[model samples]
Structures are given as structure tokens and as C-alpha cells.
Target: MKHLTDNTLNEYLDHTSDERSRKSVKDHLNGCDACQTKLEELGKIFAELQIVPEVALKHDLTPGIMTRLNLETPVRIWTRTFAAQAGVASGVLYWLASQLIPFVKIPQVSLSKAVFELQSWFAQLLTIQVSLPTWQIPDIASLLPKFNYQAPTINLPFSTVHVISLTVTVIFLWVVANFILLRSRPQVQR
Candidate 1:
């Protein structure tokens, strides 16, 4: 059997060879020591090529990143506030236009006249009952069916203590927020 050439060995090892060529290469490698040694050397070279080192980043990028973030935050806040104000103004204008439009009002009918008109309409469709049912006392015990009852299990962890703690926290935070806002707001001068 002829031994596999370097080119044929490489094609076989790289999985680019046809079945007949691959079988020929395998058969040659089984008998030929020199071809087997060459294959082993190629395998070692591929193994060495597969090993990759973790690369360390070289630059201090924090200051540049912080500058970009700081620049973006204020512009984002201003745009959001402007959009919100524009939306509110548009809604107010729409509401005002709807309310002030002269042709939209229905004639002012009194409550008694409206009720009488509704009753008349009902009378035309069907007879109206203007009386209430007479009330009678029922035997309260007989009215209800008796059953073996179990008390409901309420598994509340922090009841009054939790509520009080939450209230105190909310109040403290509100006071702190208000103080911050007051300090930050520009004072109007006379």
C-alpha cells in the first residue's frame, strides 16, 4: 500500500477528503511509521494553535464613560420634562375646547320634569309600580343553615408594628425629600 502524501494526510486530518481518499490515508497510516509520525506532528501543531491566551485590556476608560453618562442624563431629563409639559398643555387645550364649544349643549330639563317624562315613557311601554314592599320579621336562626365552622387562619407577620414602621419611614423620607427640594429650589427675591 502506498503511504499518504503530506497533502493527502492534511486533507484527511482536516475532514476535507472523500471517503475513498480518507480510507486510503487511514490504511497507509496504519502500516507506515513515518506517515504516522508526520500525522502526530500535525496534530500537535493544531493542538498548539487551539490554545488562546486571555488578553488584558490596556486603557483606563472610566473617566471617559462617566463624562458621557453625566452629559446624557441631564439632556434625557430635560427632554422628558418638556415632553410631559407639552402633553399636559395639549390635553388641557383639548378639554377647554370641548367644554367651551357652543353647539354641544343639550337643553336644560329639570329633574322632576325628566323623571315625569321617563315615567310617561315607561307607562307607554309597560305599567309602572310606584309602591314599596311591606317588610316582615323573619326567624333569623331558621333562615340560615347550620354547619361545622372552622375559624379562618390569618398568617400576618408584622401587623401593627409593620404599619407603624412603614408610616415612620415614609414620613421621614418625605421630610428629607421636601427639605432637599426646598434647598435646591431658587428663592424668589422682591
Candidate 2:
């Protein structure tokens, strides 16, 4: 005869076993000392587990969660008016630097001339033309659609002062924005 299973023993100890199952376990336990011992051990363990103290947290973590979720925390007021004024000053400085910087005579670059030189150098370095042996190559120029592509002339007359001013303006705006953002959030104490 099969001895009582752990599940059967546990259910028996918990008083949750069905009548038929309980009867089978009781009949087995009558002859089996091992099953009776196991059931008593499990019952003691269950009792201890039921009596273990429930843990209580010292601090509530709901506010931190709510702040991260942007649900409960109110949007802080714009108190950094001085920082905003500094950003305006920075913009003014950028405009002043652009105007006050002495003009330097910069050599203008012709893109068409550069392209022609590059093409000549490549042509001299590597021959792209194919000289096939008796394979009557169909004229690709005729096979393909005719393309007359003239690259648009892009002339950006940006001086050194213009470049510096542009850089300063971008950096100034970025720094000011970061300062305002960092100062705006309310510091949560742990």
C-alpha cells in the first residue's frame, strides 16, 4: 500500500482534506509512523509561520513614487528670475561680440574648382573605363536615362565672429535651461 503523500499530509494537518482523502490518509497513518511524524512537523511549522511578526516600514515611500510619476507633486514656482535675466545678458553679449569683433579677410573657396581637382586626381589614380575582350557591351549611356545634374551653389558667408557668437548663444541657452531645471525640483530628504 502507498504511504500518505506530503500534499495529503499537509491538507490533513490544515483540516482541508476532502472526506475520501482524509479517510485514505487516516487509514495509511494508522500503520505508518513516518507519515504521522511528518504531519505533526508540518503542523508545528505552519503554526510558527502564522505567529511570525508582521513587518512595519519606518517611512512611507508613496510620495517618492508619486513624484517620479509626476502625479502628486505640484509644479514648483519660477523663482530663478535672476537666472533668466543672466540668459538675456548672455544673448546680449553674443550680439555684442558679433558686432565688436574685428573683421578678418578670409580666403573664399570655390567648390566647383575643388570638385574638378578631386575628379582629376581620382582619374589619374584609377582607370574606371572598361576594355572588354569581344563582349559587345551595350552603350549604358543610351540604356540609362540622361542625367544633367548641376549641384546647387551653397555659399555660407559665416565669419569667425558669427561662428563664436552662434556657439556662445547655444551654450548660454543650454546652461541657463539646466540651471533653472535643477533649481526648480524640490529636494526630497531621505
Candidate 3:
């Protein structure tokens, strides 16, 4: 007859033992003082485990942050505007300089002369006499009409009439476009 084992005693304490095992442990506990004392110690240990508080970590994070942004600094608008104007002026000057500069010509043999030379060489190679015909091109500048201009008298208000005509044309086009857009829109069903 073996006395109550540690596992059986633990199971009995936890109320998980079968009826027969439970009765056997109870009977053994009633006769043994040592097993009863051990069970009381285990109960006290389990109760003490319930009272111990869990510790949480607290960190000082200010030292790890090495830099901060300065939000109070103001932007200089005049400096930026000056820089933009200087860039635009420089670009315009460069463009004007390029346009004013004369183009450089490279020394090259003319294509027409080269073609004539090639034909002459081919004729010499074949020992055949080739004679190219020359035709005279007539100048048409002498036939054009010549105009002699005397300054017109500023009697008519032509500039005012021109401005009025342009304004009327623009207004007419705008009205036509608006009418077309209005006619093309989808109608709602009643």
C-alpha cells in the first residue's frame, strides 16, 4: 500500500482526482500529518503568487532626440524675386547674343561641281565624248510694278473704326459660341 504520491496529492488539492483516488488520498491524509502539512504549504505558495504585482517599464526619451526644427525663421521674398529676375535676364541676354552672332561656314567642295567632275571622270573612263548643254535663265525683277508713295492726309478716324470693328467681331463670335453650347446641352425629362 503506497502512501499518497506528490502527483496524486496535487491532483487531490486541485479537485481533479477520481472518486476512488480522492477517497484514498483523504484516507491517507487523515492518517499522515506530513502530507497535510505539505498541502497547506502548497496552498499558501499559490495564494502568495496571486498578490505579487507586475512591474511596468518607464523610459526618459528626451536625451535620445538630438535635434529640433526652428519654425520662427522668416523667408526673404525680395531675394527670391531678385534671383528669378536675374535668371530670366541672363537667359534673354544669352538668346539675344546667339541671334546677333554670325554663323561660321566650313570649307567644303560644292555638290554641283563634284557631280560634274564625277561625270567627266566616267566619260574619260569609257572614252566617250559627253557635252552638257548650257541654258540662260532670265531675270524677272525688271517686270514687277513699282510704287511711289506720298504720305496720306490724316483726315479720317480709321483707328477708331478699326477698334470698333474688332470689338463687334469678338462679341459676335462669343454670342454664337454661347448659343451653340446652350442648344447642345441635354434636356431634363418631366
Candidate 4:
């Protein structure tokens, strides 16, 4: 006769075994002294576990666990102030560009001529004997101590390079301001 397994004996002691398993375990235990002793030991263990008090958790751990497992999605929050600032900045940049265009002296030149000039300029810069114009401002004397009279002037041909530089400056400022605002915004995750 084969003796019942410890699991089957434990299940029988706990009254959790199926009818067929209960009958088989009971029949084996009744005839087998070893299985009966093992069942008694398991019964004592179960009784001890029942006497021990269950402890309550201090905090809910579902959110932390879910976040660690990447099961939760993060939400980005944009403030009203950030949105307003961005809008104002965009409007200012647009206004500045529009107002400055009429003031800038851009000579009417054909597309082919402009491209040729740009290429020739690059060639001139690359050559050892670069002949770019240099601006010299006259020194101003201090007429009044409080006012400190000063005159500074810069003269250069406003070409494609100047336009590109202005455009790049505006773009850089926009990118930097937006980046700062984005970092300041809050992010929430469940």
C-alpha cells in the first residue's frame, strides 16, 4: 500500500480536499501510521498559524509597485501662466521681426546674383588674403560727468548673413524660453 503525500494529508486535515481525495486520504491514514503522524504534525502547525495575529499595512503599496513595473502613465500639466508667457513671447517676436524688416536696408538683388555673392564671400573668407570691411568708431570725450557723453557706431553691409543671424537669434531665444518653461511645469504619475 502506497502512503498518502504530505500535501494530501494537509488538505485532508484542513477539510479542503475533494470528496474523492478525502476518501482516499482517510482510507490511507486509517491503515497507515506514518501518514497519520504527518497529518497530526501539519494540523499542529496550522493551529499555531491561526493563533498568530495578522498585521495591517502602514501604507498602500499598489501605486509604488505599479510605477516600478511601468504599468502607470505619467500626465503633463501646463499652467495658465506658462501658456500666457509663451503666447506673449511669440507675439513679441512676431511684432519685432515685422517692425524691424521695414527699417533694415536689404538691397533688391536677383536670386542668382545673391547666391553668387554668397559663394564668392565664402571663397574670400577661405582664402589667406580675406578682404572683409572693418568698422572704426571715433572716441568720444566726456563733456559732462553725469551724462558721460559717448558715441559708438557700427557700419556693415546687411547681407544674407545678417538676416540669417537675426533669424537664428530669435529661434534660439524662443527655444531657450520654452525649454525653461517646460522644465518648470509639473508632471504627475499614478
Candidate 5:
């Protein structure tokens, strides 16, 4: 029988050899003292590797990696979450407006009339005889479901101006709220 080579012994010890190769190495090892001694030395080296502990990391690298990779910072994500929340809130408010605005009693044939009239008044003061387009203002109330309930009516004046102004205010509030929300969050250190 041929003597087992160092590669064959190492492969057998590492379990990388196929069944036939391992069987051949084992058969040869029984008769070859030199190969057996080499196998023992390899085992001792492997044992020493486990006996000594692995070196610890020199420094924490996760933050540096995240920054260099241009990954989204955790703080921005958390802060911008409020923008989504504000959008949801706006949707709820619009739904409420659709529902509750119908309850307010008002008489109207057109809603845009108020805005046109205002434009005309401004034009008249400027001595421009503006042919303002006739539009329905304060008439959106008619589009809403009629006040049929016997509940105590919250009698409030309804007009295109009031609703338009409020709509603008809400929109402005949403923008400011989001801007402030992001700015108020603490800066994250890399």
C-alpha cells in the first residue's frame, strides 16, 4: 500500500474527502506511522486554534457602514412618520366635513357666486368693468343632504368664504405641522 500524503490526511481530518478517499486514508494510516503522526500534529494544531480565543473587533463599524452606504437615518424615519399620520388625520377631517357640512341648513342655487361677487367688487373699485362669470356661491349647502333630523340644530352661518378660508387654514396647518415635526426631532449621531 502507498503511504498517505499530507493532503489526503488533512482532507480526511477536515472531513472534506469523499467516502472512498477517507476509507483509503484510514486503511493506509493503520500501517503508516509517519502519516498517523502527521494526522496527530494536524489535530493538535486544530486544538490549539480553539484553545486560544479569537481577537475582538477593534471598533464598532455598523454606524460608519450605515452612514457611508447612505442608508436612511433612523431619526428621519421616525420623525417623518407624523407626516403620514397628519395625512390620515386630514382624510378623517374631510370625511367629517362631508358628513357634518350636510347637516348645516342653508339655501343656495350656486356656491361660486360669492367669490365672483368679491372679484367684481374689487374690479369696480379699480374702475375695471369686469364681466365676472356668474357662478353659484353658498349653494354647496344645497348639494348636502337636507337637514331632516329633529336634533337641536347648531345654527351657524355657512358660506363659500367660511369653508374656503377654513380649508386653506387646514392645509397651511398640515404643512407647518410636518415641518415642525421633523425639525423637533433630535439629531442622530453616526
Candidate 6:
């Protein structure tokens, strides 16, 4: 026959055992001397524990405990904001690329010119006709007339240098903006 478990004995002692459990444990204890002894020992321990006085804490240890556990440490809000901003910036750049794709004209080259250019490129020679594909912003010139606005004619020759400069400027501005955002955020307390 299986003797009463420690949990059963404790539950019986604490009066937390159900009526059926109490009756079953009582029957087992009557026939089992080992179970009876174990129950008595548990009862004595419980009684002794009840007499012990509860002491108040001298210091609030929650912060120290949480710090050690690192459970309550707040995440840097700027990191999330920076990631979201980067995603949005990338999306805008992609949209701008799509809008400009229609205007980009890859100049048709003759077979002789193409062969010469390829040979020159291989030889690392100058006088290489670097015809950049022309790209324009979507129908802004046409839209201006509909809106009764005259588009300003700026005679700035768009080249690879201009595109590179524009890209570098945008990246520099984005970096500065992120740096400012990071610095402006409040520091998390330990």
C-alpha cells in the first residue's frame, strides 16, 4: 500500500485538503504508522513556524534586485524611432527612383562607338564619352501649368556629379537628424 505523500500530509495539517482527501488520509494514517509519524512531524513544524515573528524589511531592495536582474531596464526609445525613420526614408527613396525611371534615357550608341568605349574602358584611357542616363522628376513641369504656376527654368546641367552630391547631402542630413533625435531623448535610469 502506498503511504501518504508529503504534500497530502501538509495539506491535511493546514486544513486545505478537501473533505474526501481528509477522510482518505485519515483512513491511511490509522493503518500506517510511518504516515502517522510523518504527519505528526509536519504538524509540529507548522506549529513552530506559526510562533516565529515576521520581521519588517530595513531597506527597499526592489530597485537593487531589479537592477541586478535587469528585468525592469527600459529600452532606448530612439533606436526604435531611428529604425522606423530609416524604413520610411528608404521607401521615399524607392518612390523617387520609380518616378524618375520613366525620364531616364539611355542614349543609343552605334556598334563602332560601343566597341571603342569598351576598348578605352579596358585600356583605362581618357576622351571616354561618359553619356549619363538622363532622369527627370515626374511630370512636375506639366502639372505646374494646370495649377496656373509657371515652373522656373534653371539651366543647371544635371550630371552624375549632381546625383552623387544630392545623395551625399541627403545622407548627411539624415545622419544629423538621427544624431539630434538620439541626443534629445531622455536617458534611462538604472
> Best-fitting candidate, measured by lDDT?
6
Assess every candidate by TM-score: 0.30, 0.33, 0.27, 0.36, 0.39, 0.45
**88-135, model 1: which lDDT tens digit per residue?**
769978996775564344556677877776666556545433344458
Kindly give the number of clashing pairs for every candidate: 0, 0, 0, 0, 9, 0
Return the TM-score for candidate 1, rounded to 2 decimals: 0.30
Q: How do the residues 1-190 of candidate 3 rate in per-residue lDDT, one tens digit apiece?
A: 4566778878987899899989988888888888889888887877998899987759765554322212333444456545776787699789966754444333365778767766765665565333445574444344333322233233434598887997999899779857864675433211
Candidate lDDT (C-alpha), each: 0.69, 0.72, 0.65, 0.70, 0.71, 0.73
Ranking by TM-score: 6, 5, 4, 2, 1, 3
Q: Which residue pairs does candidate 1 place in steric collision?
A: none
Order the candidates by lDDT, highest first: 6, 2, 5, 4, 1, 3
TM-score of candidate 4 against the unseen true structure:
0.36
Candidate 2 — what's its lDDT?
A: 0.72
Residue 146 shift from truth in candidate 6, angstroms: 45
Model 4, stretches more than 4 Å misplaced? Answer: 11-17, 55-114, 123-190
**RMSD, one per candidate, in order:** 23.6, 18.7, 24.7, 14.3, 12.7, 14.6
Per-residue lDDT of candidate 4, residues 1-42 (tens digit): 788877777677778988998887778778989888888888
Q: Write the number of the candidate with greater TM-score, choosing between 2 and 5.
A: 5
Model 2 spans > 4 angstroms off? 14-16, 71-190
**Can you write out model 6's per-residue Cα lDDT over 1-190, one digit (the tens) per residue?**
9988888888898899899999999999999999998888888888998899989999999889966655666665467656887898899889988877666665555778767656655555343344445783454333332221233343446799998999999999889977976675555443
lDDT of 5 by residue, 19-44 (tens): 98888788888898888898999999
Q: Candidate 5: where are CA atoms >4 Å away? A: 54-163, 166-190
> For residues 46-144, could you state the per-residue lDDT of candidate 2 as single tens digits?
999999898999999998886676765665544466567778889999997776554433345478976776777566545445455676875645444
